[model samples]
Target: MMNYERLQSNINAYKKTGEILEAARFLIHQFNLDDENFAGFGFREELEKESILLTANGEIGEMQHVMIPKNIFDFDLTLVLNMLAHEMLHVRQKSPRMMILDKNEREWQAYYEMLFHTNFPQIPELSDYYKNFFGEKALIYYSRMGEGSELQLKYLEQKLEVEKFLQDIKNKTI
Candidate 1:
């Protein structure tokens, strides 16, 4: 059973955290994103010491769990908002199919979306962390993308265009 009150409180907290995510979704919808693209995305916020989780196979917004340090509530709201957007993107793209793709692609899309929609900078440590954890390939790709290299941006743009095209086709068929 779900706790409706708790869920409502989290939604309210998220609104307080930042409304940019809402705005981003509005923009996506305004552009006519296929419904299947976000069929399983949802958000949740709870008082936690330090932890964030994303289920790559769940419905968008279906996973009702995100725990941030209680101290986060007092820190920069932008940071919280950025994290929320990042996690939400994870939820939006969750699927067994996504799991089969390069993990770096997943991270790249989330970070790219967050950076594109919000004021978050591409932190050096984050790039370094990915490099350390995933190796040179991820590092090179992430750095190129983060630096706004035309080639990398073009790749991302092309990928998004393809996704939109496929989605449009799906919508028409449905």
Candidate 2:
């Protein structure tokens, strides 16, 4: 298991001046989420403690999400990008009255979007998009822990996806 201290250290050590910008570029080029400023991607110490389930709250970029930490505790650029992509999906999925009624479909689509960049072509106002669905107060919650969990498969899928996506991003950056 990866310790939090070591993982956090890894992120700090692999630091860059334009992590935010790079992330934005990544979303734009790879995910086709052409936003000039990735204002939605926020980071904090507390965030590392929350998974995507606890991170989302019917708010668009309002949630301070850990973004990339999985069970591995590694903080490489890939992990950071992976985390950002993961949270971006949540941000993309934000609806005011979001519900668990379609968790599987949402997650399935989210996973696919993260991997293949087949997401919404443009960024929309999260609040407005979900104002009627989940509202500002009604947060939809789901985890890979219940009867719906294909945890291992999802993990593998994300791992492969991140790896490939990161490589593609690397090719562009290089």
Q: Please, what are the lDDT tens digits per residue for candidate 1 over residues 1-174?
A: 124355335545655767534533442343333234344333445445554333334443344233333344443333444555555556545543344244455566665554344322332123323223323333344555545665456466644543454455456656
Evaluate model 1: give its TM-score: 0.36
Indicate which candidate wins on lDDT: 1
Model 1 residue runs over 4 Å out of place are 1-64, 95-100, 118-174
Task: Indicate the worst ten consecutive residues by lDDT in candidate 2.
Answer: 132-141
* TM-scores for every predicted model: 0.36, 0.34
Give each model's clash number.
8, 10
Q: lDDT per model, in order?
A: 0.44, 0.40
Where is the poorest 10-residue window by lDDT in model 1? Answer: 123-132
Pairing residues by index, what is the TM-score of model 2?
0.34
Q: Please list the Cα RMSD from the true structure of every candidate, rounded to 1 decimal place.
A: 14.4, 14.3
Clashes of 1: 8
